[model samples]
Target: MSSQQSIRQQYGTVQANALKLDEEKAKQSVDALNTDLANAYVLYHQLRKHHWNVDGAEYDQLHDWFGDAAEDAETAADEMAERVAALGGVPVSGPAALESHATVDFEGEDVYDARTSLENDLETYGDVIEAVREHVTVAENLGDYATSEVLRDHLAELEADADDLRGFLADDTLVLESAMH
Candidate 1:
């Protein structure tokens, strides 16, 4: 019962799949999915942090919004990871690896007001959406229609979330000492 003997596939190597997709093309799609997976996790952690620290006049609404966005990020990550495996590549794991592959940087420990938090979240969502859009194109070029479809759906959801965050930021009516005053 040796650990070495129990090992199966290795990371960064694409194995043969029943889907009949070219190994080279699958590798390309896998790389794209892995990157998206990393981005999704970064978004998830940042959103969770905001969810925990959200306060001020919009505390309840922002808290719920951040929590839901975090959940969506988690779900997207899971789907991307599974897709990576289906493409015959190992899904990237570990914080270090995820951070290395991530296109968006994680928002650190500093807790800001709800408006600022929403602003940061919107920026991160925009980055994720952009990356997802590129990956969708990559999947399409590689003939990985399933992967393209998955990323397309996530892209729509991310855009919707970003729009919601924008709405929250737009309503800055809670400010004191108005410019008109």
Candidate 2:
């Protein structure tokens, strides 16, 4: 086995940042950002799964939308990770830590219909939107306006994605019934 990597900074250890935010308060925002980061990754994978498995009369549209949403989730996760690091705390990494920190639930290995998948995505988006809104407040309360602003921008994009999912669900053009005998 190769040599293990040395730790530069340990998790939960907050250092002084150039932003001049209080180190103690920055810890709170860092913790929230890590949690958000984990949730974003969960959403990212779920979106990718739906994108790959989506099928139906609206397959083309849903597939493309899922791909876009997955990109958004990935981009949001990257930004949150950077924010956590900027706050002087080591961002949470690894599957175990991410799963433990994440409040969002995974959709698992089962493949459902396009409508069911879109509904699931909507639910996940709702959960993420709510959590992000709360975390924005947390950052603002702790005087971390930069983090709050970042989350606010992500929140708007997330809401727009969720609305797209809602629209996909609203369309009644999908063939939900099987005619094969």
Candidate 3:
């Protein structure tokens, strides 16, 4: 046999052995990915709702922020699904599956007030960022550096976006306080 074939065979054996030895870790990773994907999907829906329903003095700004947040959540959902498939697991799909796996709560009513919608977004985004940070720690412990790195980047972006929204909401107050000092 060719050297390439020999290497492939050896790698296959190694994978088989690793699977046998660490099946539980792989299962844990899959479960984490499924849960994260579900949370991302729910968050995506919430952001979409906020994008569509927000109205107030800051309607345009809130609308655009919600859209950007939804896009990021969608990207994270896709990435999680891809990672699940890459690890020899089937990606979870369907509304029921997402509902079953999601830890984030979805808002039932459409928020008409822009401030209320923005506050909701800020709260949910913070929760998801915290979860993602914990997941990154778990992935790092598992020596899954790629997953850890991806999650780290995603979490950072989410936190930064949340901070921006919070900052916007407090801009007037902050400016006033700064002038007084």
Candidate 2 vs candidate 3, lDDT winner = 2
TM-score of each: 0.92, 0.92, 0.80
For model 3, state the Cα shift of residue 170 in Å: 1.1
lDDT, candidates in the order shown: 0.89, 0.89, 0.74
Task: For residues 135-173, write the lDDT of model 3, one tens digit per residue.
Answer: 888887887676677778778778888998797667474
Weakest 10 consecutive residues of candidate 2 by summed lDDT: 172-181
**Candidate 2: C-alpha lDDT:** 0.89
The residue pairs found clashing in candidate 1 are none
Query: Candidates sorted by TM-score, descending order?
Result: 2, 1, 3
Give Cα distance to truth, residue 162, candidate 1, Å: 0.4
Report the C-alpha lDDT of model 2 over 1-181, residue by residue, as the tens digit.
Answer: 5599887887778999888989999899999999999999999999999999987667788889889889988898899999988888888888999999999999998998887888998999999999999999999999889999999999999999998888877756445557311
Candidate 2 regions with alpha-carbon error over 4 angstroms: 174-181
Clashing pairs in model 3, backbone N/Cα/C closer than 3 A: none
Q: Distance from true position, residue 115, model 3, in Å?
A: 0.9
lDDT of 1 by residue, 109-166 (tens): 8988776778888899989898999999999988899999999989988999999988
Q: Which stretches in model 3 have alpha-carbon errors above 4 Å? A: 1-22, 171-181
